[model samples]
Target: MYTYIARQAIFDRNKHVHAYELLFRDGESNCYPAHITPDEATSRLLTNSHLSQGLEDITQGKPAFINFFQDTLLHRFPTFLAPEKIVVELLEDLDVNEQLLDACKQIKQNGYRLALDDYDFDLKWQVILPYVDIIKINVSMFSQQEITERTPALKNMPIKLVAEKVETYEQFQFCLELGYDYFQGYFFTYPEVIRNKSLPSSKLNLLELINVSSAKELDFNYLNSIFERDVTLTYRLLRFINDPLLNKSNQITSLKHALTFMGELEIKKFIALLALANLSDNKPGELLKLCLIRAKFCELVSAAKREYNNPPMGFLAGLLSMLDSLLDQPMSVLVNKLPISDELKMALSGEPGNLFNYLQLVRALERAQWQLVTDYAKLLQLDELLVFQLHHQALLWGNHIHLASQSK
Candidate 1:
């Protein structure tokens, strides 16, 4: 469940830090796993860094250079990341096919900066040059003479040259003379390591309870049985149900009556919100608030979509989307433990599915990607004003809940 991310500094010509490329670690080793797709790994890393640990704390307000696979680019996963705060780094191994080219064009049009990572220029790559803002050439991969000869006279192009793996002062000088605009490698320093401290069993159990509550087989009996075992949860449930919104006339005396009156849908939201609040203890409060907003946003969107009748799953999907980051666990591991549907799991895994698209739209709204948000809203046939209002209401609701909790 432990997570870690390292950041290598990217510097401008004046030797000041311009940006950072986030590096993922599989446990103690600071390397991406060979087993999973790079997209999943990067997604998990970004979830942890941006959602769990605030981006400002990690990047110090500098733009982050994040790696993305062709799948991620095609699916527009990077849309969740703020365009002004990220430089999407395209791996060197991706094929220059039509789909990839189209995705590159779309990313550029969306106002995001792009970079070619570990570049060894092939003639086929020329097609991507116009769309990319930066090109990173690995200095160690080639000899000095080869680098000198292969370095393109791209002075006319509106792009910057980055010299990667520059290991010494002499190599830095050589790259600078070769018109490299940015430099990265041990020639500067090693990446700054950030570790996720281990959580106690009590906190993990809270996470487990939250995951268990997200199951599709949720019912009054199942929820009652679970709540009965935990007095604190029972108390919180009764208190939440008796709030003026649910019980405006009479005070609820018993848990069974509370469950009966609140209905399964309302009970599920209560449990998700309470469980999220509990599990997010010691983490940033804004994370829990954001999750709640996303949960409501997805639920509203799903209800708006007449094609799908299931809104509870949509709610759970949004609530649990950032659970991995909140708990510092891989989403695959966490979602597998939940008794949720395969469709929900697929959505959580960043697979392209119904709930996945909903989650993506919710993410776009979260980052205030207005054009993308408007496009999705139109596609879903949702009123743009309503979408904005729902988002605003969700934010206010989150704030109200937080304030109420603070008062208590």
Candidate 2:
């Protein structure tokens, strides 16, 4: 059996982590006697170090609790905490039985924090209410209309309110304005309107040339003409073509072969991204390192999960996802002119958003952005170490590609 492990950080609508490293299990297996998948181990992921560190960063308080829940078995319970570090989260679908209630009450008496996930107003489940320290509300799950109408009832409870799924900056602002204490989602990365900035003429020309490249029935000479016009682009193009990374696949020689091998449209897109990357020439080495990490991370998760039909697209999604971060442009604006698929475009929008959810999940994992990583990684069927190794490979490939281009 293969499984993926993810660290879940449980939050209230107010965006406080009542529980960090919440484990969840993933991957498929019925083989082993143990019968545990990696995903299952981490499904309610608990890592003492990562959780404590996360708590300290968020609450600036002393560690107060330490315990581990192996499914229903509560083991490794520590004597005491300062009423901060540890928080217990009731999974959204946890059955509300007397036994569970007793467990909740006992944990509360032991001086631990608690939270409820995706909580919608239900007076029946209110039995668990008094025990929970925080409550997470999905902004999308409950309409603005619902909150406006229901706040009066919700205010009667002692639990703190946390808002999840704050997708747009406007939504985030609205939630904050509406008194939501916590925020989660991709709003931080996506701007309301991606500002368009004029590129250097040389850079713009590269983008323009690549955009014009034909995907089918291409003439190598004509395609090469575009690169010849820009010495740097030519250098980078040839470098990527013949680099060790490319060497493992096929030894690319001549402009026509490059065009044919990469496909005209893909070549165009790659060149555009390459030029976008060069926008940060002075800082390429550092950014390249990070971009490679993200790319490789996404590729591994996607590849292992078997989600994408065209595996290379997943790989490219990881690789090119950082174009905006590199160019200081909103990816939407930059990608508008590229020839890549819509799914690849969606990856940049953030994971679980559209067709690129897997790729986006990979991005989240690399940054350790726990908000969407756990759930999505569960879907990807990839483990952390595999993701890490893949990210390392991406860095190596990117470095070779970068070096080869620079040499030109």
Candidate 3:
């Protein structure tokens, strides 16, 4: 029940982000299956994002572009999204007709903007041009000649043109030269790497704090000294523990007091998540969300089995599994730097152990491989239905924590 959504950034001519296009993902496959109707697919996605996953947490306050089928558009199914923060994108397959035109006009009158996705300048599409605020041209679908032939007519129109599927710097340059107002694709993620790049001092400090906090037995005096040295870290720690969801009866006055009350596991999870969020300032927030889901899933599985005496060990292993991707370093190197147990390290490295088994189970669950999930559940002596229930609960738990952290 983790509602997964994939978002790709849309950038303006100068490479500044203008918006994000949200794609529906069911966690089982990357593509939206043809069997599911657009209405059903979008309805599920809207519910997941608005209710359970948290839209602001996903988009981070940027305007989101979402696809709308002809039926959804005519029926005004997107009333939930604010006019200022959402752009209704008309999919390529939509038929241009009197009914669709009337619906588009109504949407415009209601103060919502419209964009024609994967647009081609054919005469059949001319009727909707007046209602469109933007036009997305799929670069991968058209040849240079076709694009050249279409540009003159497109230039005459008032709508802005965006180049989609721009996968190379050369393609980007060509699109820019052709007067595309915006661009989207994989070009931005492959920037040249600087040699011997290392984590920033701030990230290094946060990592150290997490490592210290994750210790099974935290020394209150030592932790307080570390917190005292960094006012920001101390404030964040205190603010987090004081959250109403934690349900503390009294206000926490000092670091040592909160540490004693909340215990090391809770503190460690909070610190690690916070540190990852801070370090991932430039990357997609979904990566951090995935990490949290994995950690919570592992922790829940261990607790359900009543094994691994230290539940935090499983959580720690799950969280650290993504460090290699986040830090752009090898997993072994990053694992060696943390002050965690050898068993946890072995588990993180895919060695056979108690924690590793849970990690593999979580991975299988994520991919929706029910056969493997059933196998693992049977091996662990867990009911398959209960495992599914726990995974869903973990998604909700992780999403709640993620939203709270964002509000801070």
Candidate 4:
């Protein structure tokens, strides 16, 4: 059986990733199987994925919030996992009783951090509050008045409050102002488009660099000139190429050599990375990381299938998909300015096609929309396991590139 797992990032107040909530699916249904008990689902997750592959590889060393049914908790399944590596989240549907309370206390005593998932303000749950380190509130489910009235009390306590299912930047700001310690949502993926805003010269320059780099035939002279014009971009590109993790045997010394060495495809990606990093100056780092993951994932999928006549175009499409979010402009406007192929422009502009389906697959995996993932995979004729593996590889590659770009 294939163990399909997707992670949703949990962000701190500053929007830095704090942890990830691991969502598991046994099949294309993208949710728990009807016949499998929650306990069995959790068991299979721990045994097949967490144990076989290890949580560190899955979570990048950050703690994972794994859900536990009352029976799973009572069976001490959490103790088998590393305490430092996971936060045991108790499902809200579980009945609060002596046995549950005792299990909570025991898990707490064993050095496990406990979180209350989808917490509603109920007096019955108060008895177990002492053991809870985090409380997740589905912000979508509560009225503003209800949230204001309920959150203040939780704020006064030692526990951290997490606003779940936040869908827009406005809601994120509201939750931040309301003293939410952590946020869980896809809000960051959206563009906070401000009308009448003009792109500054510096940003326009970056866009030009991206456009030039993305051409069917690379303009080596123009690319080298662009790099030479900005010392920081040149330094970043060189440092990235020379990153010990890249396992380069010889040092890359000059702009010309670097441009020629990386060839057309890699040079385009490097320029895109540098330009996007600069473009995302004030944005969340996770947004940039997501773009990289999408770019690589789309490229890998297209390459594996050998469907797209221009395979590298998938990479370009994925990278530019989030340009709207990074620039705070509509994708339609951005695509108009970019001198890309019609298919790429269409894909980025939300037109449906094979490329669009590739992007949808990445988004579905990110959000743990399993059924949609299956549907997209089928449309693209991709194996579910291959999709999962590609996504994992993309995550690792994206994380590495993001970290490398940040390094001095």
Best by lDDT: 4
Expressed as tens digits, the lDDT of each residue in 1-408 for candidate 3 is: 334444667888777668878766553433354679767767766776553335665556667888988788878876667787888999999988999999999888888889999986678988889999999999999998899888878888898898999876678889999999988876553322323568777778778776775787666666666667678777766777777887448687777777678876777677777777666566545556667778888888888887655437767777776776666666677788888889988987778987888888877776555567767887888876677667766766666666666654
- Model 4 RMSD, rounded to 1 decimal: 1.6
Q: What tens digits encode model 1's per-residue C-alpha lDDT throughout 1-408?
A: 223444566878776668877655443223466778877776666666433346655555789898888788888878887898889999988978999999999988999999999887688899898899999989899999998887757645788989998866578889889888999875532111123546676665565556556655456565566666678766775676666755688787786676567665566677777777777665545556567767777877777775453337888888888877676667777777677788889999999877887887777655434556667766777776677656655655655564344322
Best by TM-score: 4
lDDT of 4 by residue, 121-163 (tens): 8788899999999999999999988998889899999999999
Q: Please, what is the whole-model Cα lDDT of each candidate in the order they appear?
A: 0.71, 0.55, 0.74, 0.86
Ranking by TM-score: 4, 3, 1, 2
lDDT of 4: 0.86
Please give the range of 10 consecutive residues that has the lowest summed lDDT in model 2.
24-33
**Model 2 segments beyond 4 Å from truth?**
1-3, 7-23, 27-86, 155-157, 195-332, 335-385, 388-408
**What TM-score against the true fold does each predicted structure earn?**
0.49, 0.48, 0.66, 0.96
Better of 2 and 4 by lDDT: 4
1 versus 3: better TM-score goes to: 3
